[model samples]
Target: MPPAHSTRPAIAFAVAAFGIGTFSLMDAAMKDLALAIGAYNAVLWRNGLGSLLTGVLFLGTRQRIPMLAVLKLHLWRSFIVALMAVSFFWSLTVLPLAEAIGLSFIAPVIALYLAAVLLGETIGREAIIASIAGLGGVAIILVGKFSGDYSDESLWGAAAVLFSAVVFAYNLILARQQAQQAGPIEIAFFQNLFTAAILALAAPWFFSMDATGEIPMIAAAAGLAIISLLLLSWAYARAEAQVLIPVEYTAFVWAALCGWAFFDEPVTLTTMAGTALIVGGSLVAARAKPKLVEHTEITTA
Candidate 1:
């Protein structure tokens, strides 16, 4: 008889997939909220609310506060998260949700290169090919956008999203380092606290009370983010990171569907073409043998 296969990894993969779906819904909520309020305000309030939820969990769980070293790492990661969130939310204001999401799919490819440079992983032929395809896909999308009647604002929005993707890649690298030192709950708590603190400086100028009715949406976004973070953390803890990485690509499909259903944004040919390359490239890069170094936990909270 064939040996019984372990169900643990399969269960973890399923949870991770569900987490990705929840994250997509959170993105849709944030896009709507960002359109209602300014991106800065939306980000500020979301992080603030997220901090509250995480703080409650942190306190209730009685996790030890991080040491100075861990706290420093947390702060830096939080700053990157703040930047990534603001840029992505800003991009959503001007870019169609599907197109923006398609462009952001280059992040895993970027992460592969970052892993090589920062973590000293070997960049194999597959990674090189994947990088080329991902970059070419991004170029095609950018050319299409610029060829049309794109406004300067739209150009800036595109730039912001691209920049966010780069930062997010680095954030993934940092997450690996972080996973060794802290639990997901502690990480989420400090991430929100630090993100809110960083954005608080601009809150006075960008804050708004007019969108009070949208508070539920903002809270829901926070809730979804926290849940996704916890689910991903749990999965990463149980299974190899390589096994879970493919689950990340499912976000593209969710984004495409949500963009159509919620915002009435049709998936264009350019988006379809670009997303194909990005997803194909990411899968190629993911095939590279992951180094035996610590597994990087993904968190968007």
Candidate 2:
């Protein structure tokens, strides 16, 4: 029989995939919300409310405040999160959700390399197979979606997504580290707090409630994001970055669904085919050898 820790990788991989799906659905809402408001406002309002929501939950957990080191981790990660959100959502304003997500798919690929370098995670055989399947899935989606369109603004948006993708790669590593150090509720709380704080610095200039009509939608967006973070944090705390990261590809499958339901973007055959590859890859990643040790909680002292 496998060791007790051996089962965690599959469970964590499943949880991480579910988290990505939830976040992708949130992205669809944010795209419209961002176009209605500004990207800055949409993201700012989401995080602002997320702070209150997570705060309430954190209090319910009765967890004490994290130490200074954990606080530093939250603050630093938030800076990257804030920037990544702004750029990616702003890109959504220019490109269709599917197209934007396709561009951002580069993140998982970049993150695989970062996982090895920053976190010293091994690029295991399962990880390599999963990545190939995921990238092939993304390539198929992009080919099916793009038509060699030529728009200056769209080109700029693509660039923004690519930049955000790189930052997101690093963000994944930080997430693994942070998850090891904090509970999901605590991570959710401070991440919402510090991310909002970072975005708030430009609030007087860029923020607005002019999109008040969408306040309910914004609140829902905040709820989805927080829930997703909680799930992902829980997963990362139990699994290696290599195991969890492959599941990020599953977001495209959810994104395609979002496009179909919300944006009238028809699901093409290629989408179905690509979605299959992503799911297959995720399963392979989940099948990773659980010989590795699971992450243990780091102490405050």
CA lDDT scores, all candidates in order: 0.75, 0.87
Model 2 lDDT on a 0 to 1 scale: 0.87
Q: TM-score of each candidate?
A: 0.81, 0.95
Candidate 1 residues lying further than 4 Å off, grouped into runs, are 1-17, 124-147, 235-248, 273-301
For model 1, residues 109-132, the per-residue Cα lDDT tens digits are 777667668756566676577667
Model 2, 153-271: lDDT tens digits are 99999999999999999999999999888778899999999989999999889978696889899998999999899999999888888888888888887888898899988888988
Best by TM-score: 2
Off by over 4 Å in 2: 1-7, 295-301
Error of 2 at 140 (Å): 1.6
